[model samples]
Target: MTATIDTMISRLAAWLSRHSIDVLRVSLGLVFVAFGTLKFFPGVSPAEALSVATLEKLSLGLLSGYAAQAVIAAMEVFIGLTLVTGKLLKTGLVVMTGALAGFFAPYALFFTDLFPGAPTLEAQYIFKDIVLAAAAMVIAARALGARLVPVREPLERVHELRERAAA
Candidate 1:
């Protein structure tokens, strides 16, 4: 029974990796869509005020207010659609990564506000993007079949040279 259960668990893991990855992708896309849609109307998203403030501060006043917020919302919606539809998933990952970089700034820029006592709701919310970013990385890796290797790993060229020398 134990052996049978172990086999089933292994199969389930494989099934999730092979057939259910898209589920994760779509769910993340839905999250982006919901957040972006919320931004379309004022005071709908809890993160709106913080987002606007962060954007203004990051852009040094060049971008702010409803206009800047609208632009961000549109971007999130576009990326979300791309992921949801599985069209240009790679490009969507790139865009998502870039957007998350901006999003992550608040964790540092507003550290005091975010962590005055405990992390405020806004801070906690913004911080969740890190996990989302990590999820995106995994999705992108699976989508691309990326293999992670150490930086000091020997290059293919070196291996080829060694083979030639042996010959």
Candidate 2:
């Protein structure tokens, strides 16, 4: 029974190892697209006010209000399309890095607003970006040719299995 369970677990892990990164990339892309689309409409995205404020501050008063929101929305949508389509992914990841930095800028720019004795709703929202950043890192690594090798088996054994499966 133990051997059977281990075999099943290994197979499951192998399947996940094969498909998880692509799933993550697509899911992240969808999230970006959804949020970006929301920003296209004024007063629709919950992050709109804070996002505008952050951009205005970061751009040293050069960007603000609906214009700022539109810029961010366009950037996010572009990143989403590249990630989803796997075309110009390196360019998308580059833009995503900048956007992620902007996303986290509020912690420094509006420390008090985001955290006035216990975390506010905006703080909670920004905190979730850490996960998105990490997911993006994984996708970027994969784009750079990294693979998720299962750990239960030896590297050689895993390669052998993959080779046999390919045959």
lDDT per residue (tens digit) for residues 77-151 in model 2: 999998898999999999999999999999999999999999999999999999999999999999999999887
Best-fitting candidate, scored by TM-score? 2
TM-score of each: 0.79, 0.87
Compute the lDDT for candidate 1.
0.81
Please identify model 1 stretches exceeding 4 Å from their true place: 1-7, 147-167
lDDT of every model, 2 decimals: 0.81, 0.94
User: Candidate 2: which stretches are off by over 4 Å?
Assistant: 152-167
Please write out the lDDT profile of model 1 over residues 18-37, one tens digit for every residue: 65667878999998888988
Instruction: Itemize residue pairs with steric clashes in candidate 1.
Output: none
